[model samples]
Target chain A: MLTIDSLTKRYGRGAPAVDDVSFTCAPGTITGFLGPNGAGKSTTLRMLTGLTPPTSGSATVLGLRYPDLPNPGRVVGVMLDASAQHAGRTGRETLRLAASLVGVPAARADDMLERVGLAGAERRRVRGYSLGMRQRLGIATALLGDPLALVLDEPANGLDPEGIRWMRELLREFAAGGGTVLLSSHLLHEVEATVDRLVVIGAGRVVAQGALADLLAGSGVVVRATEPDRLAAALRAAGVTAAPTGDGALRVDADAETVGRAALAAGAVLTELRAADGGRLEDLFFSLTGAAGSGAPARTEVAA
Target chain B: MTATTVATTGDGTSRALPEVPRIPFSRIVSVELRKSLDTRAGTLLVAAAVLLTLAPVGWQLTHLTDGVPDFDLWVSSARGGVALFLPVIGILAMTSEWTQRTALTTFTLVSRRGRVLAAKLAAAVLVGVAVMAFVLAVAAAALLVASGLEGTTPVWGDVGSVVGGSLVASALNVTMGAAFGAAIAQSAAAITMFLVAPTLWQVVGTALLGDDAQWLDVFQAFARLSSFELAGHDAQVVTSVLAWVGLPLAFGWVRALRRNVS
Candidate 1:
C-alpha cells in the first residue's frame, strides 16, 4: 500500500507546489493520479519516490518512507522522468547498469529489453533514440529489479497509440498479479483507460479521488435543453442543485430520470439528456477542478 | 540501507516470489567501473590522457639532448603529463550523474546514494592507479631509448620513488577533481573550478598574504607530496591538502546524499 498523509512542498515563500495532500493506493489496483499543468502531480510523485523532500507530512510505500525501505528499488520501482537515462550509454547498457546496481543478474537486462519491445534497439545509444524509445528504455530500467510496486509519472507521454495500449495492458497485468501502481498523467483518456481508481488534483490540492466507477456514478446527469436557464431553475425548484456548463447544458447532482421529470414539469424542451458515458470522467474532472465554465460545455458539445 | 523486508503483497498475503538478496559493494563498484569506461566522454578522456603522456615521452626520447636522461627524471616528466589531464577523467566520472540527469535513475536503483558515490570514487581510484602504471611503462620505454643513445646501461635503482610518487600524486589529483565535481554537480562548472579556481586562489594569496601564502598554497603542498624528504613542509602539505580536498569533498558528499534527486 502507498500512504501519503498531508504531504506538502513549498518552494521558497511561494505557495505549496503540493499542498497537504493525502491518499492511499492499495494493492491489486492501478491508481491514476490525474492533474493539469502545474497541478503538483509531479511534485507528489517526486515526494513519494524520495526525489524531492516534503516540507511537511510524509509519503510512504508499504508503510515506510522510500529512503527508509531496505532495497527500495526492489520494493518500489519509479520512473519520474523517462529521459533521465544516460544518453551516452546504449539501451542494453543502461538496463545492465540498473540490474547491477539492484543486484539482479545481468541477463535481466536482455529480458527487459525484449519485454519492453526494444530488443532490436538494445545496442543503440540513447542519444540516437526517439522519445518513444527512451520511454521504453526507462520502463525497462524500472522493471530491472522486478519491483513489487511502481510509481510512474507520465509513463504514456511519448508513446504512440499502440505503445500506450501495450503499456496499459502491462500495468494491468502487474496489478492483477498483486502489485501496487500509482501512475500520474495529464492525459484524461489514457488514465480513464488504464486506471481502476482516479486521484485528481487541481491547484496543488486533491479535488477528487476514489474508485473510477464510484466517482463517475456519483457525478449524476449531464442535461441539455433549449431553455437551459429555465431547466436549471426547475431543477433548483425540485431541490436538485444544477451547475451551469456555460453552453446549452446544466449538470445536476441527480439522476437523469429525476432531471427528465423535473424538465417535463417545467415544460422545457429537452434537446439532450443522458447519463454522461465517455464524457462522465471528463465532466467530473472539470467540475471538481472548477473548470466547468466555457471549456467543459464546449468540449461536451463537440463530443456530442 | 541494504535490504527491505516487505515480502508479502500489500493485502497482507504472502505469495511465492523469487528472493532478491542485498547488493554487495563489490557489484556496485564493478558497475561504476564499467560505466566509467563505457561512455564516449570517459573513453575519450582516458585516451587523451594516454596520448598526452606518450607525447612527452616521445619528445624526450627523440630529442635525447640531455645525455642519457636520468630514468627517474624521464618517468617524472611523463607522469607530469598524465597527472595534468587524468583529473578531468575523474571529474567526468563524478559529475556524469548530474550532467546526464541520471541521478533519478541511479538513486532509485540504489537508494543508498552514499554507496553509489563510494563506488564511483573507488572506480576513479582504480583508473588513477592504472593511468600511473601506463605512464610508467611509457617512461620505461623512453629509458631504453635514452640508454641506446648514450651507450649507458639503465639503472633500476631509482624506479621506486618515481613510480611511488607519481601514483600518489596522480591519484591525489583524481580525488581532488572528484571532490570538486561532487561539490559543483555540473561538468563544465566543476571543471572550470577544478582548473582555474586554485590558480586564482594562489595568485590572491600571494598578493594578500605575501610570503605567508606559501603555507596555504595547494600546488606548493602538492609539489611536496611525493618528496617528504624536503623537510619542514610536512605541516604545510597536510593543511593545504585538507583545505583543497577534504573540505569540499565533505560538503559535496553530504549534499549529494541529501539533496533532492529532482
Candidate 2:
C-alpha cells in the first residue's frame, strides 16, 4: 500500500505545486491519477520517488519513506520520464545495468527485452530508438526488480494502439498479482479503460476520488419531452434539480421512475426518458474542476 | 525488509516468496566502470589521448639530432601530451548524466545519490591510473629507441620522480576536470570553464601582482604541484588546490545532492 498524507510542494515562495493532497493506493487496485497538464501529477510522483523533496507532509511506500525503504527499487518502481535514459548504452545493456543495480540476475535483462518486444533491437543504442521503443525500454527498466508497487507518469503518451493495449493488460495482470499501481495521465479514455479507481486532481488539489463504479453511479436521469422547460419547471417544483444538457434534453437529479411520475403529474408528455449515463466520467471531471468547456450541464447537447 | 509470515492457500497450506539480497557497492562501481568506457564519445576521447601521446614522441624522435633525447625528457614530454587530453575523459564521466538526461534512471535505481557520485569518482580515478600506466609504457619504449640510436646506456636516474610526478599530475588533472564537471553539469559549460578559468585567473593575477609574484597565480601554483618539486612553495600549492579543486567540488557535490532530477 502507498499512503500520501497531506503532501505539499512549493517552489520558492510561489503557490504550492501540490497542496495538502492526500490519498491512498490500496494493494490489488489500479488507481488512475487524473489531472490536466501542470496539475501536480509529475511533482507528486517525483516526491514519492524521492527525486524531489516535499515541502510539507510525507509519501510512504509500503509503510516506509521512499529513501528509508531497503532496496527501494524492489519495493516501488517508478518511471517519471520514459526518455530519461542513457543514449550511449544499448537497449540490452541499459536493462542489464538496471538489473545489476536492483540486485536482479543478468538473465532477466534478455527476458524483459523480449517481453517488452525489444528483443530484436536489444543491440541498438538508445539514441537510435524511437519514442515508443524508449517507452517500452522504460517499462522494462521499471520491472527489472519485480517491485510490489509501480508509479508511472504518462507511460502511454508515446505508445501505439497495440502497445497501449499490451500495457493495459500488463498493469491489469500486475494488479491481479496483488501489486499496487498509481498511474497518472491526462488521457481520459485510457484511464477510464484501465483503472479500477479514480483520483481526479486539479490546480494542486483533489476535486474528486472514489472507486470507478461508485463515482460513476450518478443519481440523475435524462428527460426529454414535448416542452423541455415546462418539464424542467415541474421537476424543480418537486424538489428535484433539473438542468438542460444543451441537446434538447433535461438532466434531473432524480431516478428515472421519479422523473416519469413528475412529468406525468405535470401533464407534460414525455418523448424520451432514460437514466443518466454512469460512464460520463469526463463530464463529471470537468464539472467538478470547473475546467474550461465544462460549462454547467445546462446547455442542450446530444445525449451519449 | 522482508517478513517470514506465510499465507494460507485454499487447502490451508502456507507458501512464501523467496527474499532477494540488496546490491553491493562493488556492483555499483563495476557498472560505473563499464559505463565510463561504454560510450562512443568516451572511447574516442581515450583513443585521441593515446594518439596525441604518440604524436609528440614521434616528433621528438624525428627531431633528435642533439645526441638523442634523455630518457627522462621523453617520459616528461609524453606525459605532457596525455595530460592535456585525459581531463576531457574525466569530465565526460560526470557530465554525461546531465547531457544525456540519464540521471533520472540512474538515481531511481540507486536512490542514494551519493553512492552513484562515489562510483563515478572511483571510475574516473581508475581511468586516470590506467591511462598513466599506458603513457609510461609508451614513453619507456621511446626512451629505449633513443638510447639505442645514440649507442649510450639508458639512464635510469630520476626515473622514480618522472614516473611518480607524471602519475600524480594526470590524477590531479582528471580529478579537477571531474570537479568542474560536477560544478557545471552541462558538458559544454563544464568543459569551457575547466579549460578557460585558470588561464583567465592567471592573467588577472599577473596583472595585479606583477612578474615577481607569479606564484600567486593559481595556474602557476598548480604547475609547481604537478612538477612534484617539494623544495619550495608548498603553501602556494595548498592554496591553489583549495581554490581550484576543493571549492568547485564542494559546489558540484551540493548541487548534485540537492537538485531535482527533473
Candidate 3:
C-alpha cells in the first residue's frame, strides 16, 4: 500500500505546489492520480519516492517512509520519468544495474526485457530508443525489483494505442497479484478507461476522489431538452447546480426525477434525460473540479 | 518520523515480506566503475590516457642518452604526459549524471544520496590508482629495453620517492577533477573551470603576487608533490590543495544532499 498524508511543498515564498494532499492506494487495486499539467502529480510522486523532500507531512510505501525502508528499491518500484535512463547504457545494462542494486539476480533483467516486449531491442543503447521504446524500458526497470508496490508518473505519455493497451493489462495484472499501483496522467479519458479508482485534483488540491463506480454512481443526471438555456435557468432557480457541456446538453447535479420536475416547471420539452454514466462523467468531472480550460479550472462556471 | 504502518508487505502475494538486504557499498562502487568506462567517450578517455603515456616514453626513447633514460626520468615523462587527461575522466564520471539527467534513475535506485556520491568518488580514486600502476609498469619496461639495447644497467635511482610521488600526483589531479564535477554539476562548464581556472590564476596571480602566488597555485603545488620535494613550504602546498579540492567538495556535497531532483 501507498499513503500520502497532508503533503505540501512550497518553493521559497510561492504558493504550495501540493497543498494538503492526502490519499491511499490499497493492494489489489489501481489508483489513477489524475490532474492537468502542473497539478503537482509529478512533484507528489517525486516526494513519495524520496527524490524530492516534502516541505511538510509524509509519503510512505508499504509501512515506512521511502528512505527508512531497509531497501526501498525492493519495497517500492518507482519510475518518475520514462526518459530518466542513462543514455549511454544499453537497455539490458540499465536493468542489470538496477537488478544488482536490489540484490536480485542479473538474469532477471533479461526476463523483464522480454516481459515488456523489448526483448529484440535489449542491445540498443537508450540514446537510440524512441520515446515509446524508452517508456517500455522504464517499465521494465521499475518491475526489476519485484516489489509489492509501483509508483509511476506519466508512464503512458509517449505510448501508441497498442502500447497503452499493453501497459493497462500489465498494471491490471500487477494489481490482481495483490500489488498496489499508482499511475499519474493529465488526460481525463485515459484515466477513465484504465483506473479502478480516481483522485482528481486541480490547482494542487484534490477536488474529488473515490472508487470509480461509487463516484460515477452518485454523479448528477445528464439532461438535454428543447430549451437548453431555459432548462438550465429553471434548474438554477430551484437551487440545483447545472452547466452546459461541449454538445448541447446540461449536466444537472441532481437525480433524474428532480431534473425532470425542474424541466417541467421551465416548460421545456425533454429530448433525453438519464443518470450520468460513461462519457458523461467528463462533464461531471469538469463540474466537480470547475471549468476545465487552459488553466486552473477557471472560475467554476456554474450558473449560481 | 511519526509511527505508522500499512497492512501489506512486499511479497505481492499477501504473505509476509521477505528480507531485503541493503546493497553493499562495494556493489555500488563496482557499478559506478562500470558506468565510468561503459560510454564511448569514457572508453576513449582510458585509451587516450594509455596512448598519452606511450607518446612521452616513445619520445624519450627516440632521443636516447648514453644508456636507457633513468627510471625516475621515464616516470616523470609518463606522468607529465597524462596528468590533464586523467582528471577529465574524473570530471566526466561526476558530471555525467546531471548533464544527462540520470540522477533521477540513480538516486531512486540508491536513495542515500551521500552514499552514491561516495561511491563515485571511490570509483574515481580507484581508477586513478590503477592508472598510476599502469604508468609505472610501462616506465619499467622502457627502462629495461633501453638498458638491454645500450649494454649498460638501467639506473633505478630514488625508486621509492620518485614512483610514489607520481602515483600521489595522479590521484590528486583526478580527485580535484571530481571535486569540480560535484561543485559545477555540468560537464562542459565543470571541465572548463577545472582545466582553465587554476592555469589562469597562476599566470595572473604570479604576475601580481610573484612568489606569494605559490600559496594558491594548485599546479605549482602539484609539481612540487609529483617531484617529492616538499621539504619546505609545506604550508603553502596544503593551503593550495585545500583551496582547489576541499572547498569545492564541501560545497557540492551540501548542495547535492539538499537539492531536489525533479
Report how far residue B1 has shifted in candidate 3, in Å. 30
lDDT of 2 by residue, B215-242 (tens): 4456666567667774677777777787
lDDT of candidate model 3 versus the reference = 0.83
lDDT of 2 by residue, A135-241 (tens): 99998988878887789999998999998999999999988877789999987787778999888777777767788766665537778999888898889888988
Across A134-220, the per-residue lDDT of candidate 1 in tens digits comes to: 988888887777777889989998899999999999999889877888999886887788898888787778777788877666667
Per-residue lDDT tens digits of candidate 1, residues B1-262? Answer: 1133535665563332235566688888888899998988778878888888888888877787767777787787887767777677678778999878998888877777898899998899889889888888888888887897789998666577777877887788888888888888888998899989889989999999997887778877876886545478777788888888888888899999888777
What are the RMSD figures for all models against the true structure? 4.9, 4.9, 4.7
Task: Say which docking band candidate 1 falls in.
Answer: acceptable
List TM-scores of chain B, every candidate: 0.90, 0.87, 0.89
For model 1 the interface RMSD, in Å, equals 4.5
Model 2, which residues run further than 4 Å from truth? A225-234, A260-275, A278-280, A287-304, B1-22, B61-64, B145-152, B210-228
Q: What range of 10 consecutive residues in model 2 chain A has the weakest lDDT sum?
A: A295-304
Per-prediction TM-score, please?
0.88, 0.89, 0.89
